[model samples]
Target: MTKVWEASVRATHSFLSETSIQKIKISLPKILQQIPDLIIVEDEKIIAFMGISHQELEMLFVAPEFRGLGLGKQLINYAIKNFDVNKLTVNEQNPQAIGFYEYLGFETYRRTETDDAGNPYPILYMKRKEN
Candidate 1:
């Protein structure tokens, strides 16, 4: 969603180009359909959602007004607790997200390419090992 970017620090970063934003918006709904397990966070006036697939995670979004309140961590931890496998991909250039994933004990497993709109984007594969 463009609105999500409008409220996110990542939006201001060079990695969030029009192409990337458009690709994310277009792909999110389809991804959600395939991964119906969703966790949502609601504050006074803001709501965010994160979707969990078989072993993958995606579509993590917090409303602009509700950023920086540890909602992301809560949502992610919820997924970790509920799912057997924990994996996510962050764009290579999105350092903030990469660092956040690392803080949550996700380690980079590989660098890969995603076919988004017939173009390739670099993504870092991160996984949290099971205990």
Candidate 2:
């Protein structure tokens, strides 16, 4: 799972410094342990994962090899259907993620100049628009 997360981050989170990535890598296991609902896709090893809490999709990661294979969409749709996940935050620098979520009916409702850990990366708070 950690491998999946690291690989996904490395592939998508290009704005992150190696130092920040290292910090996140060190903390990801504990963070995953804390998510109230953790979902995984596996084939011998984990191929993708999601962390949900309080109706929010806290994290989603797909291995590079598994990307473009709809694994991310499947996991996110599962989270929305099963866990009532309607909210999530994405790094503003990650335009691909923004477009992905927007395609799934999410809209940005707020923005912050710094991430939760006080990092310089901008954050966008998004929610699934109610039908």
lDDT at 116, model 1? 41
- Residue 95 shift from truth in candidate 1, angstroms: 0.1
Q: Rate the local accuracy (lDDT) of all candidates.
A: 0.71, 0.93
Worst lDDT run of 10 residues, candidate 2, spans 28-37
Residue 49's lDDT within candidate 1 is 78
Per-residue alpha-carbon lDDT of model 2 for 48-124, expressed as tens digits?
A: 88899999999999999989989889889999999989999999999999999999999999999999889899999
- Measured with C-alpha atoms, the lDDT of residue 127 in candidate 2 is 99
- Candidate 1 structure quality by residue, lDDT tens digits, 100-129: 889988999998776344446588888996
Candidate 1 clash total? 0
Native-referenced Cα lDDT, model 1: 0.71
Candidate 2 runs further than 4 Å off? none
For candidate 2, list the clashing residue pairs, or say none: none
